[model samples]
Target: MQIPTKFYKIIAIFSLFFLGILIFLGVVFKIIVEKRKLPRLYIEEKNRALRGSIISAEGYQVAYSNKLYKVAVNTRCIDPQKKELFVRLFSIYSKIPPHEVRQKLRQKRGYVVLSYTIDTKTAYQLKILSRKLNALDIFIPYKVGQRVIKQGLTILESGETRNFPYGDTLTPAIGYVSKYEDSGYTKIKGIKGLEKYYESKISPKQDGVIRGKRDIGNNIILNKEAFIKKRLDGYNLHLNVNMLLQKNIENILDTQKADLEAKEIIAAVMESNSGKILAIASSNRYDPKNIQKRDLPSLNPKFTEYPFEPGSVMKPMTFSLLLEHGLVSPLEVVRGYNGRMKLGRKYITDEHKFDWLSAENVIVHSSNIGIAQLAQRLSYLQFSQGLKMLGFGKPTGVDLPYEKGGKLLPPYKLKSEIYKATVGYGYGMTVTFMQLLSAYNLFNNDGYKVTPRIAAFITLENGKRIFLKKSKKRKILSSKTVATMHNILQKVVEKGTGTVAKIDGLEIGGKTGTAHISRGGRYQNAYITSFFGFANDAKHRYTIGVTVFEPKTKHFASQTAAPIFRNIVIELINEGYLIPKNEQ
Candidate 1:
């Protein structure tokens, strides 16, 4: 191995350099691995102390998370005499049976959770018990649970839970939640009303970890060392509904339903110019908070679900269409004698017979013959197209769930004269209340059809507010047609069937409708009561509609529904939402 001194020195230096490079690379790799693992450890540590506060709109804490002690015992650590006394005292204070306490004490496990989330009073009592019994293994560990509704009893005597304060008032609008017996988790269900429709947005997220049960006689220790993910609360909803107006409207409906002894009542107040629903009240509504069982029919309503012949209300649409197409003028006279007209094989009759009635008089009197004759003048295609344009035979695209799109007979498949005549009077078809309201928007908004919405704005937990803008208005009718329809509706209240709804000081314009329910393809004598009105003040605008189904006594729209409209309008006037024209 005899090598030169310079070569040997060079080899030694190269070897040292290679060794140092290896050491430096190893150190760098170790640091990279440690950095990668650091985030997970940090996450676990932070989650162990995770806490959040739930604030209301007024910035008060509705719920929050705080640290507290969970008390437990290892029965094996104490003498039998001391254990028996400790178990007896604990049973009385903690409400666990002494026998179960004795059994838990006999277990070989080192830790057991006797009670979780104990208050200061109970903690003090447990401390006293621990001293008196001389038991050193009365364990108390830090834990967290939600502290909600700060000043209420955890469990009430009536077995009814302490829920949102305005439960009954918001039942139909805000839904309820219930537990699944099989899953053992709270599920947001649309037991009824708006809750069901917006359940996805309102429901709280579920924890993916499954709950496990401990063996009998073993101490149950929740791994305080184990990691748990925190849950995010459901989004808060801000509705266009004015709660004050909603309460008053509910009260009014309750009072009226009692006075009239009506079977069912529904009233909806909407912003005339914007189509924002201010309040919707239905009498005989079930309490969402207390519903142990679901009654499908009574929970929603016939107004939203059941579609019936709208009767004379369809008259306005017909008249509007006629005017829009330049087919008729308000003053044009038509022969409607004896209140009857024969169209093909079907005979259409008005409630009262009159001769030489003008189109204005026809709408004022709600002449069925006049409307039917006017419809006959238009080709079947034109009539159907007009209806479709006005949003009939389609859904109104309202934000609420389970809205029904009214049914209309196919124009291509019309096989009978009776079917056509029946449709002329709002028969042989069906329409939801929302659809009708949307259709009426054409008459109110100068033929600009606006989509209806319930949510006015959404507020985030960080105090950010986002307002929902209305969609662009669709033009469905000419201004001239709208003007003519407005004149006809004005006459409807001035000297017509809707006169009962006339406000004393304000200019009120609307229509009245009474439709008979059909059973087994025959028109039943049972009638539905309805009244729709739009009022404009110098600054404020309002549209109100009321519908009552199967009233006990008189069933006419003018007698039953119109008075309710008048009451609401009177209140609106009194509240200054509608000022008297003379004041302006």
Candidate 2:
């Protein structure tokens, strides 16, 4: 055993050979990796893409874009054995879903975004996490600075994110946006409301290059050629809505939401002649900032979406139809069976007892039996045509999203006379609050039909502005018929259930509606209290519609919606919109 010098020499030679090979391989690998991850010098880039803005007619920015960042990592460079630890630590700072991090770690190569939302503060913490673990593999696409590099984390200036300055105020109407990445390209998608409807006009994909030049320190150079972007910025939508009126509407609702015990309340104000929406509001609102945090039900938009039985508000249309077609005169009397009448299988009831009432009394008293009796005289064609003339059974053609036309059955589908009778009293049919508003505006606009609109105009960066033209004009009723209808509605406020809506020395015409909301297969006790009206001054006229749903404190529109309507008019007038003749 002591004479084993040959064996010892052989073992030493083998060990030396293996050690030299190991050092050579290590040097080669380090050189390749270092070259591959070498820092670059002086970069030029462009970001010509700018998300468009939504502005009001008064030139206030409602929705605009703000820059945001996305943080990501090259999975191949991260420690493989410590993938779980990496995921846990990454999620702590990134706020990304843990399961999502795990799935990305499985890739073990290429790139996976830790978060599409790395802000300035968060970007700093990400740097700390990366430094503590030394796991970040920086790959700056364009700009880089000390601000850019923290620990080993990569900060990608991932273009812009949308912001609503007024929060949920115009959300359902203005809509919202979401982000997605496909084929190495990032995009913003308009997901709802006006955002989606005007997507092509507003936040369309970029049309030009976003160019910029930077020095070694990532300092942006201010050179014309170095930073040039042929910016075809999206057009700025100027809404017809008046911010003053909109604010007043919302403020009043907020103060009354709890007192009314309302599950929801929807109201709209439209120009009597042009149908331009001045203000539209809802009680149950959603915030675009924290939209994802709330339940989906909270996001249900009521302005142009919620459709319900329109109730006695339809009485005016019934009276207008009878007047327009010369089917009946204002003073013509109809038997009401003393405020109660059975027609076929159903019965119509009135709040007041009336054996016989004038056709005008039918509307003034909001008598269901009276209107139903008058409706029995008309042919199905006349009955259906009357509703159509007032924009019922049709979508109001509003630019907002998810607008429902509400159901309108043809004459043939009328299962019984009761169904037709119910339609007269605003049952067996459904309509959106906007549609109801537009229909009533016919009386205020001197019988010339007006189509409801939300957008007023669009302004572009080049100072070119295009105003939205009025829809094709159509006269649905004669001037005389409108006058007659207006007189009847005036009587409703003066001597009827809607008396609470009356303001001193102001001529107003309104109708109250209280209908049981249909749920599951049958009507429920849940009610939609509504008041549709026009507030008239010498020079100013506004048509308003207020609807409150499932109120706990009150079940009547006169109690819940009318007084709110009165208060709104008072505020708007006090704000100097309406001026009475006596005051003038």
Which candidate wins on TM-score?
2
When superposed on Cα atoms, how far off is each prediction in RMSD?
12.9, 8.8
lDDT of prediction 2: 0.78
C-alpha lDDT score of every prediction, in listed order: 0.66, 0.78
- Prediction-by-prediction clash tally: 1, 9
* lDDT tens digits by residue: candidate 2, 136-252: 432223224422332245666665677787877855677777878644446676788777878877864454543456665455666775545565767778888877778778888
Judged by lDDT, which candidate is best?
2
Q: Mind giving the per-residue lDDT tens digits that candidate 1 earns over 1-584?
A: 68799998999999999999999999898878764422122221111121122223233332223323456654334444445656777788766788877776566655566655465455666656655444353332332253211110121011112144554664454444443322321123444445555555544443323122333322233465444555444445567666666667778888878877887788887786777887777776655546646534566655567676788888888788778778888888977868777877767877778987998788888888877777766667777888888898877766666667888889853335566556666777888777777777677778888887766654544657666667778888988888878778878898999988776567678888889888898888888878876877767767778887877678888888888888888777766678887766
Segments in model 2 whose C-alpha atoms lie over 4 Å from true places = 1-44, 70-156, 182-186, 204-229, 292-295, 413-416
The TM-score values for the models, in the order shown, are: 0.72, 0.77
Show pairs that collide, candidate 2.
Answer: 45-211, 45-212, 46-210, 46-211, 46-212, 47-210, 47-211, 48-210, 136-152
